[model samples]
Target: MSGSEDLLELAVETAREAGRMLVDKRPVDGPDVVQTKSSPTDVVTQMDRAAERLIVERIRAARPDDAFLGEEGGTSAGVSGVRWVIDPIDGTVNYLYDLPDWAVSIAAEVDGVAVAGVVEMPRRGETCTALRGGGALLRSATGARDLQVNAAVPLGQALVATGFGYAAERRARQAEVLTGVLPRVRDIRRGGSCCVDMCSLAAGRVDAYYERGVQAWDVAAGSLIVEEAGGLVGGLHGAPAGPEITIAAGPGTFEALHDLLAPLDPARD
Candidate 1:
């Protein structure tokens, strides 16, 4: 069986390759839309599928027995304990618009627990990676550096990062929830990508992050990055971070945001 570091190495290599492919083949006019899901604003692009295929094929060649859960491709079962959770393009809308906030996120889960993860932002020219117990690191053109979340920031002074759902109803409820969250914090940033926001939190670019209606593929890699960076990533009322809602922040900031968000019931769509 492969070790955690081995999985992390594969994730990093695959993510970097996928990021390169997406960037190189990107059309000057933008990518072609494959279709939309859940809502019209929730889109899938041809590059999304190509990236997922490339990632899965590359990893499967090295670890054929492993499973997969991809955002573009659905779940595929395997006998091996390792299962890859991937978001080929975490911010398709941003990518479609030629924005730089999109990312290629991949996480290797052993027996349902993510042991290693990578979130590669090609446009930003940075990659974030973490192993089970290993600390998170950010790699860029200049060099690489270990990542750490901001110190225990009070909720009132926290600069929170977040994203909205694609559906109109969910967006409406999220906006309502934000009305409560906006005034309580120092300010808010809607970054358009969950993995980017989580990585931003890990790199101390943002004090905290919270979002509703995110899938496992969205947070699987980024959450591990945050936790490994000496932060907390979870749901409200002691739940694990998942689709209902996911929040991440440093020590005091996590609890403060959690307590503040619990009453708002941001989970409701």
Candidate 2:
């Protein structure tokens, strides 16, 4: 059986390889088959499927007994007591428009807990990796640096990052939640990539992050990165982060934001 550190290495390597494939497959003029899911604004491309295939292929080769739950591909069972949660093109809209926020995310879960995660943002020219209890690290053109959330920033002056859902109604309700939470913070940033936004929080590039109706693949990798970086991850109202909502922040900032937005939680609303 592979150890957590080994699994972490495998996750990072696979994510980076998939990221390079995505970058090469990216179109200069227009992406092929710009498809939509859930809403018109939500997008996907041929590259998304291809990248997922590559990741699944590689992971299967390494750990044939492990399970998989991919954004592009549905769940597949295995007997290895491990499951891989992956998002081939995390920010497909950004990738379609040739923006820099898109990423390839992969996370490994042992039993039911995330033990390793990797997010490779080719356009951003950085890769983030985290191992449970080991900590998170960011690698770029310069070098690698340990990640840590900014605990010093107070709620009023915090620069929070976030993403929206695919449904118009969800987006509308999210907008309402934002307005309520926005005035209490320094400002807002909508990067269109949940994986990137959460990694930014891990790197302390942003003070916090929150989103609703996110799937397991969406936050599986990024949320682990945040937790390993000394940040907090949970639902809007002390519940655990799941499909409902994902809220991440530094120690003090986490408490403040959760309190401010708990009322906006869709499950409760």
Candidate 3:
């Protein structure tokens, strides 16, 4: 089996390469739309496909036997038991609007478990990385520093971040859940990017994050980072973080937020 450090190195390098490609190719007016998925507003751009291709190609060149699960390219089975989960652009809306919350996310799984992860935000000039047991860190022009979630913040004082789905029905449900969550917390932020939101939690930029309709590629890297940074990342009903829901936060805030969200049925749509 390949070591976690080896996988992390590849994840970080590929993420950085994809990030640079995305930044250089992003047009001033935004990328050309390829097609829509779950909704008309849930768009996929040419850059999204191109970036996924680049990342898959680079990783394949280094380890041809490894499998892949990409947001844009979908999945390809392999025999190596190491799979790369990738989101070429985690915040497509922000990237399209020239916002700074977009990122390239990559996580390497060994035998169906994430062991290494990377999230690269080119616009923010930041890269977050983690190994399953090693811990998480943020790297930028300034330097590299270990990351940690803000300690056990009370639920009411927690600055929470969350995202909504593209479908109107889902959005409405999410909004309904928010009506209950907003008044209880310090404030709510809709960053429109799961990886960015999770990275923010790891970096102490947000006290917690939860979203109802995220995919594996969206949270794979960010969740690992949060876990390594001393935060809990999970779903409702004692489930692992998946489409049903994903929530991340420090100690006290995690349980409080979970209990609060559970009663609200944030997963319902």
Q: Go through the candidates in order and give each one's C-alpha lDDT.
A: 0.94, 0.88, 0.94
Off by over 4 Å in 2: 265-269
TM-score of each: 0.98, 0.95, 0.98
lDDT by residue (tens digit), candidate 1, 1-269: 45999999999999999999999999989999989999998899999999999999999999999999999874799999999999999999999999999999999999999999999999999999999888899999999999999978988889999999889999999999999999999999998999999999999999999999899999999999999999999998999888899989999999999999999999999
Clashing pairs in 2: none
Model 3 CA deviation exceeding 4 Å by range: none
Clashing pairs in 3: none
Clashes of 1: 0
* CA RMSD of all predictions: 1.2, 1.6, 1.2
Q: Residue-wise lDDT of candidate 3 within 131-198, one digit each (tens)?
A: 99899999999999999999799988999999999999999999999999999999998988899999
- Give Cα distance to truth, residue 5, candidate 3, Å: 0.8
lDDT score for candidate 2 against the true structure = 0.88
Better of 2 and 3 by TM-score: 3
Counted clashes in each candidate structure: 0, 0, 0
Model 2 earns a TM-score of 0.95
What is residue 149's positional error in candidate 2, in angstroms? 0.4
Model 2 RMSD vs true structure = 1.6
